[model samples]
Target: MPIKFEIGDIVHLKKNHPCGGNIFEIMRIGMDFRLRCSTCNKQLWLERTEVERRLRKHFRNDEEIKS
Candidate 1:
């Protein structure tokens, strides 16, 4: 099944970002997705398929607090 995502959701990418962070926040979603790197605060736009392929895991705010 396709993963459900929302704005503000935190996601970990399978590969580390060039900025040395794997964590990102979902900024916008559609045919394309906008992500902001957690460490460097850089923004990136990627296709939904690419994002899904690279997705490692996702954590909501409550879930993040618990971890």
Candidate 2:
């Protein structure tokens, strides 16, 4: 089964962002997803498939969630 995501979730991506941040918060979800980097506070837009593929971890309220 596919992973489920919520709007306010914080996630760690498999790859480091150019800004050297891997932590992000979900801003929008659908065919495309909008994420804001926790370190740089920069927003990114990515496809749902890409988001899932790059997802390394999930978090809520600063705690990690096991998949």
Candidate 3:
């Protein structure tokens, strides 16, 4: 099964970010994705494929979504 994503969803990536956090919030989705680091509040633009590949888990409305 594939993971579904929506704006404002929180995601845990497979690897930690440079800020030492693995969590990020989804900001925008379309041709690319905009994700904000949960720790540093840093926003990054990434391709959809990259986001999907890096994603480990996802949450919506504070509830984890099983994939």
User: Which candidate tops TM-score?
Assistant: 3
lDDT for predicted candidate 3 compared with the true structure: 0.89
Q: Candidate 1 has which clashing residue pairs, if any?
A: none
Query: Each candidate's root-mean-square deviation in Å?
Result: 3.2, 1.2, 1.4
lDDT of 2 by residue, 1-67 (tens): 6678889999999999899999899999988999999999999999988988998899887778887
Worst 10 residues of 2 by lDDT: 58-67
Clashes of 1: 0
Clashes of each: 0, 0, 0
Q: Where does candidate 1 stray beyond 4 Å?
A: 64-67
Q: What TM-score fits each model?
A: 0.87, 0.87, 0.90
1 or 3, which is superior by TM-score? 3
lDDT of each: 0.87, 0.90, 0.89
- Residue pairs that clash (backbone atoms under 3 angstroms), model 3: none
- Pitting candidate 1 against candidate 2, the one with the higher TM-score is 2
Q: What TM-score number comes out for model 1? A: 0.87
